[model samples]
Target: MSARQRNAAFQAFSWLPHDLRNDNAAVFAVRIKDLGAGVQTCLQLIETSELEREHIRFDGPPAEGDAADVPLLSVTDTSILLRLAITIAGVISEQAEQFCQASEDRLVKARSAATSTGVDHE
Candidate 1:
């Protein structure tokens, strides 16, 4: 995802609740990143949608009074959300780079095999 898309996703997930973040906080346990509960909640929502679905549904529009358990994504500071967006975007960029590298390697290997086999290389 580009930075634009990443920011949009971060903005979208700002409604994530507290428990969800705490549940998935272990993902970053090996690493040390001091993220707020609200930001962590949003990250969890993005990383673990299956568990998040059980806690918060997005299949359809929420009903009245159904938002009782929901916590604000960044109630105190939009800056938090922005910072998290940058972090999330960095992760996405790394993944995309890896994927692209794999794709290029596959392409090179395929071409090499085709040439060695004397097949009609395209």
Candidate 2:
């Protein structure tokens, strides 16, 4: 999937409660893969406490290389997967808003052009 799609999927999956963040959650093993390419990045959620465990990855497509073998997220560790996820979601949302703004601008320009040319828009 595209990075946008992957980001979207991650955002959707990350919204789950701490208890349901495991593989048993609605969307488990969410492999975003290659973010931009279709490379698969798998997520293996393990529960330890309200917030502590490993988000392991047995396979990470290829772009990730050996880093995929490492835990992608873990409250036990110092890495900020949860925080990163939130940041990614914010970035994705901003990008979406920008895309919508650009689209609306294009439509406005098109409408203006049509009016200037006396072309029927409807």
Candidate 3:
């Protein structure tokens, strides 16, 4: 599906009844570190991989200005980070789908019960 449809599917809980919404608590995975560690983190991501001397491509960093001043990751290293993001987003989408489906089912059952009991379910 398109990204918009995926996003809307992820937010499908908004369409559920209030009672069904109350049954869910969203879960997220988070990483936390002490302050001022962000710069170090970025540096580590790039420096973690070293280009070999025999490499035919990339020719060892750039011949341009300020190689020492730049924080750059090779394509392979950057791909790892991008894949992590995609994996997390996929998890979130799966969670949303399960939650919304369960919620809709619960609401339907609740309404059905109410009607069978001669109660007005508006």
Candidate 4:
């Protein structure tokens, strides 16, 4: 999956449906911290074994002038803060929808397989 898809999957799995329904700084900060930990865990897993590290290469950090080195937002007004919150809420809502759809699809596939094999998946 692409980075965006991976991020969406992480968000979907990390936060509950109710958690993603809010978009305040405190909630966002917690989500950011959790995502950072998840990313670090994935990196550590990738580097765990010598064979995997040798075959799978990761690029170095971004250069000094890159966007990653810059902060994206600074809120000086309530209106701007409100807009930011709305945008975050929209993104999180979309991620939740995607998660729900994927879950339903998986459930359908599992049921189909169980029927074919004469097994009770429930």
Highest lDDT: give the candidate number: 1
TM-score: the better of candidates 2 and 3: 3
State in Å the error of residue 61, model 1: 31
Q: What digit string (tens of lDDT, one per residue) describes model 3 on residues 97-121?
A: 7867988999999999999999977
Please provide, for model 1 over 40-118, each residue's C-alpha lDDT reduced to its tens digit, 9 standing for 90 to 100.
7666654454444455664554678776544344333444555676786677566556656867998899999998999
Candidate 1 clashing pairs?
none
Q: Model 3: which residue pairs collide? A: none
Candidate 1: residue 63 Cα off by (Å): 30
Query: Which tens-of-lDDT digit does each residue in 43-109 have in candidate 2?
Result: 1232232122222333324364454343334444323434444555565566556656867998899
Top TM-score: which candidate number?
3
Q: What is the lDDT of residue 98 in candidate 2?
A: 69
Which ranges in model 2 have alpha carbons more than 4 Å from their true place? 1-79
**lDDT, model 4, position 64:** 73
User: What is candidate 4's lDDT per residue for 1-122, written digit by digit as tens?
Assistant: 35687567355544535545454444555665655555455444433443333333354445677655222222233335445555655666665676668679988999999999999978
Q: How accurate is candidate 2 locally (lDDT)?
A: 0.45
For all candidates, what are the clash counts?
0, 4, 0, 0
Superposition TM-score, candidate 3 onto the true structure: 0.47
Please give the lDDT score for candidate 3.
Answer: 0.53
Candidate ordering by lDDT (highest first)? 1, 4, 3, 2
Where does candidate 4 have its weakest 10-residue lDDT segment? 69-78
Instruction: Quote each prediction's TM-score.
Output: 0.38, 0.43, 0.47, 0.39
